[model samples]
Target: MNPHNPNRHNLGTVISFEFRRTVLKPKFWLISLSVPLLIGVVVGLIALSGQTTAQRVESQDTASVTFTYTDASGLIDPTVARTAGGTPVSDAAAARAAVVAGTSQCHIDYPKDPLSQPIDVQGKDLGLFDSSRYNAVATTVFTTSIEHKIGNPTLAKLAVNPPDVQLATFADGHATAGIAGVIAPGIFLVLFYMAVLMLGNQMLNVTLEEKENRVTEMILTTMNPTTLIVGKVLALVGIGIVQGLVVGIPASIVFGLLSGSMGLPEASAGVPTLGSIPIDAGAVAIGFCLFLFSFLMFTGLLVAIGAVMPSAKEAGNTFGVVVMSMFIPLYAGSLLVSDPHGVVSQIFTFFPLTAPVSTLLRNATGGLYWWEAAIALAILAVCGWVFLMVGVRLFRTGSISYGSRVKIGRALGWTTGR
Candidate 1:
């Protein structure tokens, strides 16, 4: 067998060993299965709560509410009151008597100066009335009456029938994409966040565990440190892919069901639901590539850090910086949402640690230039290679030094003897 090729048999053995050890662990199964299950349960509860609320509102609106009112100012004619969906009573005494006798659901008293003084409302069950609808109707009646009295026909006409302003953006005289432009990016961002958080922490813990338990020494004796690291990293990537599918598929189904049951459009009028948002296959492919490369780069850095630490606790203490770098995009999420092409977003796109999320967001939002994305990906690939080489060197040299923690500068100074 050639020294480099080292028999495909050996590499397979290493990969199989790592894969089985990881996949069969109870912790792995727990995390992979629980996340999607929890998300589905929560979404179901929320949908049920919303449905219950809607039923209550519909029931309330359908119930008849006979309202009697006395207009002391005489501005409100009996016709106007009737048209406004209220029964006109002859006097305040009549309105009050009707309400108290349960003949009417509510009584309204319009003051002498209806505009200047507050309107007094008495109801047997205040909750039964939709205050918003009643307030709107009362406002229209008072404003119309005042305008009529003032003799401003134009103002009255404008008040009664406001100009319908349908705002639209034209791309070469055609309407551009609607709410999906805003929403699709948000969905991509969330998915990217979940993937990185779950996979990155797993990488960190796995790498640190080998160092903490002194297993690196035993493994290094049989396999090249670089080979051992590569095999483990590949195994973890496989695990991550499985875990992502496990969580994402069920969550997506649940989200779709929730959106449909709630009468959410697949992307027309209001908040865009998952089914409604149009996904660009090409953009998604590019985003996946970026995510993959970024994950490798982050895992490499974590593995390098773990190799230098004396124990898992120490590695964790220093892992905060790496975690913070991964989440820098989250901290600047507002800037990305408000102005994806702004200076802040540009900085994030170019910076390796923040590039994955920033590029995905800009791509999803249709703000990323082709050249910018190409450059970002190139930078990420290079950084990932450098990190992998550095991690291999650190693990090779520092694995035997268990007396104290290895400084990063010293670890970087060490080189593989080719």
Candidate 2:
């Protein structure tokens, strides 16, 4: 706390050294670049496959098929049926018998009382989707016959296929992007987890590296543990920011180029240019706050675990458990979105570990109320601070306890030393 403290002066030095130590590694750049590159490769393959399939579909007439029809409704034009590869048959029984006997490809029976009886279509049992071909062929024949009767092709076409209806929703007497507005906060949620997942190991390594190298005692002689850990946390945050830019920028560029062709729903359709997505400023503010506190909470907890753990191998399983806990709320993601006030969602929103992700998800879906956001943010902020304090205490007690795990009771002053 002293202004003249050398440890305070050395804080900047520690941050610089830690930041340079991490970013200078070849592995860091490789892993950072690989995420976007890997995603690009997978998406490229899927797009190529889709294009190939579309080409194959266009190269062949998928609807062409042979069938027989008996139109007692006087609706079937003989010329149209023949043109569509459907032969007109007088005996409906013979038509069906021919199909059953394999003498015909399929049979369609247009009942005399078309108003009361259904049109019957029979074909060899093909798979579910493929077997609809008989109905498709018969439908084309009937529609084309109706078009001829109407005399005006355009009018008949309009009568058969009505104009599409576009539905728009308004909020506050103004047209809003509807679901697009609701999902806009999800960008913050995505960035939060992206940094957490990418930087979790780094949090553990930052503190553990000193212990592993037998340098913790020596380092503590020169710098306060609090300053050292705080510096490392700050440096890790900087690294996360850089990595986020690395991954997020390229992804944004690729998505902007591909969104139109990707058939994204209206909410996120087309390139997400400025002012295109209806983002609620309040929701985004809440989301950004939650993201920051959540990242800090996870960082503090992971760093605390590193302080207590003697080696990476000893901490691996614990690290996996903590990571899994962050995703637990996602399993009930649908419930969170559909019924944010539901019992399950409430539990996840308040629980120490699950609160960050669950609340972020609810905020993204427009389900998080302001009061709930306040409570969630307060909980995360307190937990982050508490976890950081716990990490410092654990480091003081366990940093030099090599080849053994530290007992929480002693590390946290819950029990006296022997």
Candidate 3:
């Protein structure tokens, strides 16, 4: 293999090796498969329990629950209890006797003014009745009796059909969509953050592992450092994509099922569901570009940091810093959600470190102008390229220079031969 033209074969070999080491490992498969399966099992059991409970509730609802009542008020007509599907006993003792004899499940003693004076309600098992329905029935009995005594039966009829007010909400001059609009983007942000962190950590660990085990020195004999770094990063990118699909597809399906089960509206008049949010091909393309380049920029920094660190422990500290930087945008998430195009949001969108999350958030919430997205992507692409070049320089210089730790300033100086 020619030294200058050896990238093709060498790149393939490195990718293949790294892929097997990380993506194709037994643990990766176990975690990827087990998590979703466990979630599904747990959810299924909960749903089954809920269904059993609902069936029990429905059966109780259907069973006749006779109420024995003493109308001490003298205003309540015995026909009212008969009409309401209840038996009216002459006195409280008779009512209790009826309950004991299994002739009635509940007993009510009405006062002269049921609304002003507290009514006595007793039952064998109060839990057997749907509380809300039982309350409504009791209220109806009292109100109807009062209305009949007052000679205003029409008022009682009107009370049963009260007026309702419908409510709607808007944000930024646009009507807020259903819960999907909020939930879908949130889900995207979380998934994106997890994928980036997981893959970035993996890349960092691989870089540090090679350095710690002296594997880089042996591999450096056959190929250029640039080729090795590029290949490994590319392999990690592939693994990230595959891992995303492995996790994302099932999660999406489950989310869709849950959304449907919960009776979330598909789409409002002008608002979009998760499925409908992109709205056009251009937005989709730009969003993908932002995610890809943003990922490259962060992973490149992780690789560079890993190359410079002398041990896994040191790499961990650097990894924590980078992870914390990613979370900075999350702290101001409410501001971004409320005002996607505000000053602070614009700063996050333009800043390379926070651009991916900020831009994606803006895109998901309302959207940014095409020009804004283009500018952000351009900035991210440049940052990613610069980081990649810096990582290559760091990897080349620091790969063999073990024993002493590599300082960032010295590494830059060495890259310039100063």
Kindly list the per-residue Cα lDDT of model 2 for residues 334-361, writing each as its tens digit: 9999899999999999887999899999
Candidate 1: give its CA RMSD in angstroms: 5.7
Q: Give the Å error, residue 12, model 2.
A: 1.5
> Candidate 3: where are CA atoms >4 Å away?
1-4, 38-187, 268-286, 414-418
Against the unseen true structure, what C-alpha lDDT does each candidate score?
0.70, 0.81, 0.71
lDDT tens readout by residue for model 1, 27-133? 88898789889988897888888888787667654545557777888887566567667787778787787778877777778899855999877766455446444
TM-score of every prediction relative to native: 0.75, 0.81, 0.71
RMSD of 2: 4.4
lDDT of 1: 0.70
Best by lDDT: 2
Model 3 per-residue lDDT tens digits across residues 1-418: 5566567888899899988888767888777766566656675676677788788666654555567677777877667667776776667887778777876778878877765998777666555446434554565677777677667777766765666544455656766664456444444455567667667667686567778888887878888888888888888877766766676667656665555444345554565444433132344456556667777778788888788888878788878888887889888888987888889989998998888888877766655777888899899888877887788887777777676577676777744544
**Ten-residue segment with the worst summed lDDT in candidate 3?**
272-281
